[model samples]
Target chain A: MTAISGWGRYPINDTEMIHPRTVDAARRATVQANPGIARGNGRAYGDAAVGVRQTIEMAHLNRMRAFDPRTGQLTVEAGLLLTDLIATFLPRGFFPYVVPGTSFITVGGAIAADVHGKNHHCQGGFGQYVENILLVLPTGETIGASREEHPDLFRATIGGMGLTGTILEATIRLRPIETGWIRQRTFVADDLDTTIGALECGDSATYSVAWIDCLARGARLGRSLIFLGEHAALHHLGERHVANRFPLRKPSMSMPVDAPSFVLNRWTAAAFNELYFRAGARKAASSTLVPTHPYFFPLDALGNWNRMYGRRGFVEHQSVLPIKNAQTTLAEMLDRIAKRGESAFLAVLKKLGAGSGSLSFPMPGYTLALDFPIERGLFSVLDELDELVVAAGGRLYLAKDARQSRATFEAGYSDLSFFSEVRRTVDPAGKLKSRLAERLLI
Target chain B: MAAAEKAVLILGGTSDIGRATALAFAQSQWTVRLAGRSLADLQREADDISVRTGRQVTAHPFDVLDTDSFTVFVNALPDLPDVVISVVGLLGEQPRAETDLDHAKEILRTNYEGPALILRVFAEQFLGRGYGSIVGVSSVAGDRGRGSNYFYGSAKAGFSAFLSGLRNRLAINSSIQVMTVKPGFVRTKMAEHRKLPPLITATPAEVGEAILGGLNRRRDVIYVRSIWFFVMLIIRLMPERIFKRLKL
Candidate 1:
């Protein structure tokens, strides 16, 4: 047994980990004495991907089963990462329809979380693009689940947090692109009202997101810089950019050691936010053409960026409020943080479209995600925020939640009973359970 | 006929290192044939390679312990391979092998007898055709038999000596070439549990690249990581009196 943790590096657990290379081996792993959870890249920021006793690392099972260039449909093993897919097909004019902030997550993990990207307002979550899935049950029975066959299982497995079973393979539809360049526009919003106005105006863009200055208070409350982007067409690219249609570069530098907690205080964060806002305002026409990597995943350029939060690690709290109440709920939450002198190092706000799955964490609204380093009484502050969010008819994303009460979770998601009923029927013995599942009574 | 597509046959193709070598050759436009006890397991790998590299890859059944079927297995191939690589090895439990005779015998048969006999069959065909190359995957453990894994080490020692003698016999009589490969601490399914130092350990893909490079250069003996050549020299030069008193 060895110690393993998710991306946040909090709540580490000692578990028996196995890497199975084939479907038969994966089936055998499901029948082990201890209940197992299939881990893909461990990018989920909490205990949802970590098991109590056993964790099955699915890196070795990555294989591309089939790819039809004409239809742009690809069948791949569950362990294949989005980064690998981009490297292989981006040059051939293909890209995933919906991609999360980071491209390091696995296909199975993406489906389990039903991850949404900047284009969520137009494309929807990752589950919407899934054609079908192959699952290996705890009883060692392999079944193919799709819209037509086992529709209930299909809905439960997507955004199911891997509680139903281990996902073996999946067939997903890929979007065709002319190039890997993104034409982007930046707008600086001085306060919450302006930020919300900018986001609403850019709802028709292919992709749109906002970087919020959570430390800003008074007249500058909820100040943010909104970025809007669309895939660059062949005719839109410059001569120099055409030569490198698909470009990928490894992280130029990395955090070799953990930083001191005191180094990331309110003073440093405020200065950084000021400089970032000013930099965005300086650009003429507030527009530029950038490679997909930097435009989509800025944090990925600095490897081990999480270590900057120090040894105690951090908790990423991402909550979504219905559009009707989003502006008020978000302003109240931001005011609470500023009043306490507690600042989030990174805060993101995005608009989400309609959702379909039972446990999917998206709606026709706005979602705010923030990262705060663990410290004394941090849980109490987060608990208070949860009450406000629940009252506003908002829900926390399971993929990023580390500490949330069962009552809060139940209040946020009204379909909890239906999800529980489906889970019990599929996994009656509770042979597949995660720490997050047990904590939330899912 | 498109130059009859040069091919290589891997004996233990289910192994990580063996699969990597098959992929390397297939990427270079070589037809690959993978042989192992279970054709079903091998077929999955074959299909994966075919999709990735768009090359001709086929899997066949061959039991290393079944000596009687060796000739039949080779004759059943669609075309005689231009190169044959022997990667079959068993690192059985050292403590169990030391106490149980059956475990010791299994280590010897898997590492030495099985691979040596299968290569002998291919060597005969190459000698008659006056062309082809044979590569044997030996280990640095064979250079000096340590008490921890001497059962597996001794079998590799025998395989290394066999390849050396075969090289000398074919040097003047025929163009058939024999090469011995000694690797130190390659990261694969076989060495997953071992606590190996990261700097000295090489990945299976690295070992595969070295093997292909060595075959292209036709070197008589090569080490996967060149540092292992000097490390083994120091071990071989130690006096018996000093070595016997200390544990390796």
Candidate 2:
């Protein structure tokens, strides 16, 4: 047994890890004495990928099975990393329809979390692009599930957190692109209403996101800069852009050690926020054409950036509310956070389109994500925020959740009973379980 | 038409190192044929490589213990392979083989007789064609016998000697090449239960790439991690008077 933790580096657990190189080996591992969960790159931010007893490291099972260039349909083993896909296909004028903030995640992890990206307003969640999934059930039987067949099990497994079974493989539809550059434009907002208004009016762009200054107060409350982008067409590219297309530059910088806890106090956070906001304001000029790496995955440039939160690590609170209550709910949460003198180092907000799947996190509204270091009274504050979110009919993203009450989870997801019914039918004895499932009473 | 794709034949295709080596060769545009005990066990890897690299990969039935079928196996291939790799090895229960004669014999045959016979068959074919490369996966355990697993070690030692002599004989014509790969503490299914030292352990992919590099350079002998070369040299040079007293 070895100690393993998710990307957040919190709640570490000693797990018996097995790396299966083939599908048959993975199936045999599921029937082992200890029940386990499938873990892919351990990027789910919490205990969702770490089981108490065992963890099947699916990285070795990565393999490409089939790909049709005409229709842009790709069949790949569930362990294939998104980074590998982009490195192999982006140069060939293809990209995943939806991609999360980090390319380190695997196909299985993406489906289990139903992760949404900056383009959620146009492409929806990652699960929306999946056409079919092959699952290895607890009974050691491999079955295919899709929208047309076994729809209930398919829906339940999309965001089921590996409680249903081990995802063996999946078929996803990739979107075609002329080049690997993004035409980007930035808009600065001084307050909450302006930020929300800018995001709502920027529907013409395919990809949209906002970086908020959670430490700002009074007239500067909810100060943010919204970025909108569309794929750069082939005709728009100049000689230099076309000559150096599809450059996948590796991260040049990384945090070698954990920073001291005192380094990220409210004063430091507020100063950084001021500098960022001013920089954005200065850049509000003619649109710029940026490479895909910096445009979509800005944080990825600094590997292990989470270590800056200190030894206690941090928790990401990401929640979505209906369009009608999104503005008020977000404002209330931000106001409460600021009043308590607590500020997050990074804050992101994005608009989402209609959600799919029974337990998918996205809905037709705005979602706000904030990262707060673990400290005294942090849980109580998050608990109060959870109540506010529940009252506004918003649910937390389970992928980023390390702590949330069972009652809150049950109350937030209205289709819990249906998901439970499908899960029970598929895994009656519950051979596949994770710590997060136990915490949420799934 | 473009020159016919060069081909590589991999024995024991289900082994972790074999599959990784096959994929590496396929990525280099080589048509791969994976042979193991059962086609079903090899089908997944063959299909995966075919799709990922757009290369032709096929599965065939081959049992290393069935020495009589070696000639037929080579004859049945669609096209003569430009390179052949033998990754057949078995680490049976060391403690059990210590007392059980049958278990010891099985280990000896799996590590020595079976692989040696198969390579001999391929060596003859390559001699007639006047071109080809033969890679035999040996082990550092063969350098000096240890009390822990001498039965398996002795068999590997015999295989290593056979490869050395084969290299000497085949290099006379300078058309066919024979290379011996010595891998130390690879992280494969066979080594899952063993507690390996972290500094010396190498992944199967690492070993696979080393094999390809060794073949391309036509080396007489290559160690996967390179550090194992010195580690084995010290062990082999140890005086027997003191070496026999130690339990390692």
Candidate 3:
């Protein structure tokens, strides 16, 4: 048994990890092992992909099955990483329709989490682009799920958190692109109201997100810098890149070791936030052409960056609030966080459109994601925040949740009954299980 | 005149390193042919690489143990490949190999004799063509045999020596290049059971790039991690009186 943890590095578990190379081997292992869960790259940030009995690592099962260039349809194994897909096709003028904060995630994890990207306000979640899935049921029976076939099961499995079955492969639609560049327009919002207004104003953009300063209080509370972007057309390319529009470069900076917990205290966080806001404001002079990497995934430039949060690790509380009164609710939540005096190092706010899938996290609202180091009394503070979210008829994103109570989850996801019914139909005995499922009593 | 497309044939194509190397070569605009025991698995890999790189890829069945079929396999190819790589290896349980003669023989044959024999066949073909590159994937464990896994280590040692002799023989004409790749603790299926040091263990893709780089430079022998060269040299030069006492 090897000790493993999610990307957060907290809540470690000793699991019998199985690595299978082929689809047949994966099915056989699932059939023979005890209750288990399928893990892809371990990018979930929480225990949603870990199981005590077994955690089948699916990295080796990655392979491209087919591709139709005319229609931009690609079939790939579940273990294929989004990074590899982009490396192969980005130069060919194709890209995944939806990508989350990091492209290091696997296709299977994206589907299981129903992940959304900066463009979520317009394009929806990753599950919306998935055309079909080949799933290995708990009983080891392989079945196909798509919109026309097993539609209910399909919806449930999309964001079911891997409870329905182990995903073997998926067929997804890729969007055509002219270049690997984003034409970015930055806006600096003075406070919470302006931030919300800026996001609402940028809804027509293909992609939009904001970096908020949680430590700012009083007049500057919820002050943020919003970035809105659209894919750059061929004509937008400068002279240097016109000949080779899809230049890709790997990240070179990496955190070599776990930093001391004191490195992320309030003084450092406040100072960092101040400098960051100023730099962003200064850079907001005019529209700029940025590479896809920095425009969409700036944090990825630093590898193993989570190590900077310290060995105790950090937890991210991400919840989506309905449009109605979301501003007031966000103000109240930010007020509580500011009063607590604990630093939230990375806080993001994005607009979300209505999403498909029974357990999908979006609901045509605004989602605020806050990262706080695990320290004394932080859980209670997060508990209070959960209550505020629940009261506002919003739900927490399961992909980022590690400590929310079962009651809180049930209160948020009202479509649990449909998910449970599909679970019964596929895995009656609950042969497929995970730490997240156990904690949430799914 | 249009230049003919360069081609590479990879034996043991199902292995991680082989698959990765094939991808690297294909991405560089070379035709790739994958040969292994399972045509189905090889065909799937070929198709995947073909689609990803938009290069020509084909699969054929070849077994290292079946030496008699080597000639037939080479003859059946549509065209002679410019480069051939052998990446077959087996890491049997040390305890089982120590006690069971069948397991011991299987380990030795799989790691040493089989790869050597297959490469010899390809070397002959390359000599007839007057130009070619041959790469053999060996291991650092062969540098100095350890008490814990001498059976596997010794086989790799023999394979390494065989590659050296082949390189020496091919240099007589100075046209064929024989390269031996000694990777240390790669993070592949063969080493998954052991908890390798993250600092030293290389991903298969790293090994693939190293192999391609070594071939491009015409390096006779290359270590995936440069640190392994010093580590192995120290172990090889260690006094037997002191080395035999400690566990590796």
Candidate 4:
């Protein structure tokens, strides 16, 4: 089975897990299906890749159907991975402008989620970078999308969570890189305010992110470390320069099994955070040699870091808020979590840049992603967070959502109805659906 | 929904918890702006917000790293918002990170550097505006780290601490509201799990509600679900050596 979701751990009927090696095969598989999903590399980490009765493995259909060098635009079967694009284009000085956190994902999957990258603050997401897309609607009809063609469907398809239809191919723009390495720097913020202050105090760059220590208590509750980067100047390439044009040695490992849940309690995590915090002494460094794939998506290399959550597998609660709610909102949230005693041991924060896409996830405010083992009463806490987000003038990412309610879905993404209306006009039958769509009532 | 037309802005517009929180505001009475990097993705989100809340909504482009422009974005807005939700993160790999320093660097940078800078500007703006709520999504991970994603966890640990400091600073200035949201397990795309057990897991909506409730009560550092209070209390008591050997 491909790695689409932690949910796929559930036993699937033998009829599921359909591997389709070609476009025709995928079509045939769908034509004679036990109800399935069009799966890519399964990097989505959600149930969207899995089907109720069957799952169509679309990796075999990967192929670069076409390319346009001058525009740095290319068309490929949806199954293609960012890795594939990087390999095919590095020689041509082009790359997928907006990538997710990893290179293991597929072109179709990226489109489905309208994935963003560190440069999202600059380039937006895959949706904006996409010049066009080829999709197989729920009605089994193949179609294309662009600014001018099926505009609503195009918008809906991006970050649509693979609910609109099966993405067949996408024409996307590429980015230019030098030696495939980033010029990076790091800064330590004594507190959340300083960290927030530093990010805005710096110059514009291609990428930026932050890590915070939440357990310090009192004065250091939201203290953090910030890092910023820009594409290395092309002229800076030295004799030591090298290009890691391919995935070296298939960097892969799997979680042999789930560990115990209580393994990551506060005391253990607090020590780890303290020990880990003082280790990063390097502020600014320039090296000709950096693995582009690993640098862009190191988590993918771990294969199963989720096992760190133990047998129950964990969930990520990520969200964004406007500048107005920056301090107090965060304070209230941390206090609430502390008061309740949930150990979301890992929380990372980042500032967003300005860019727009139909189905994108980054924004101008701060964003936080935290991992937590599933437990009781968690939902109510999330519900409180939902209220705060509402009052604060923010929205959540649908592609990353799983347990959100229909009311919340409607509240956060009120504009989806227009997309939904258009979707209804396209496939009136509601053939394209997933657990997310069901739960959110989208 | 009303002539006052309160609006909520989610800076980390792509996070599940952020989205769910936004939905909660929509349900009440507020125009929702699904602010983020991709306007298209946020457009659908805006649409959803309006439908749920029966309020007008729109998607706007924003850049937290560019605080100079943040005010411009706000001034450019048709109306200023009453609340803000910030949920962001980056979990870098710990193993490869030890060998590939860049991986480790990205993990720390993504979690701390970016968010810290922008929130400063947000606070100043809030002071000038004299009325607003800021919900920063921090994690219990920052409370500490395990062998896994330690760099990422430490960054969050730092953020969690920072939020507390910010709250204390804002307390004297009653005009501003700060809420730190720390949730344990939330079922979302980032985690990708089904049947998250009852003891620790939560949905984005649940976290959303808790955050709002905390905001209304003017509380600080809200746990998405209350059970995490007990769970962490126990986890914090475990001995270090024993905790290290723990396979969890």
Best by DockQ: 3
Native-to-model Cα distance after best TM-score fit, residue A35 in candidate 1, in Å: 3.9
RMSD each, Å:
2.4, 2.6, 3.1, 30.1
Estimate, for each residue in A1-442, the C-alpha lDDT of model 4 and write its tens digit.
3434533232122325776645656666655544455767765544556665567777755656555556776777788777766765665566677777778778888887777776665556777888898877666678898889988788788777776777877888876655566666777777777777776665376676767776756677677666666655556555555433332425578778776877877667777777756764344332333456666776777776667777655566677767678667776666667666677677777666542444455567777766666666776787787777767766666655555567766666646767687667765766555556655666
Instruction: Return the top candidate by lDDT.
Output: 3
Ranking by DockQ: 3, 2, 1, 4
Candidate 1 segments exceeding 4 Å error: A284-286, B1-4, B128-130, B173-175
Clashes of 1: 0
**TM-score comparison, 2 vs 3, better candidate:** 2
lDDT of 3 by residue, B105-140 (tens): 999998998899988988888888789899999999
Clashes found in each candidate (C-alpha, N, C closer than 3 A) = 0, 0, 0, 208
Give the per-residue lDDT digits (tens) of candidate 1, residues A1-442: 9887788888787888888888778778876626768889899998898776788888888877777889888888899999888877787788899999888899999999999999898889999999999998887778899899988888888888888889999999999999899999988888999999988988889999998999899999999989999999988888898888776645557899999988777788778778888888776246688998888878778888889988989899999999999999999999999888776888899999977677888888999998888889888999988998899999999999889999889988876777788778767888787778878888
Tens digits of per-residue lDDT for model 4, B124-179? 78788788888888777776577776788888887777777887998994778888
**Between the candidate structures 3 and 4, which one is better when assessed by TM-score?**
3
By DockQ thresholds, what CAPRI class is model 4?
A: incorrect
Model 1 chain A lowest lDDT segment of ten: A244-253
lDDT of 1: 0.87
Q: Worst 10-residue stretch by lDDT in candidate 4 chain B?
A: B45-54
Q: What lDDT score goes with residue B232 in model 4? A: 73
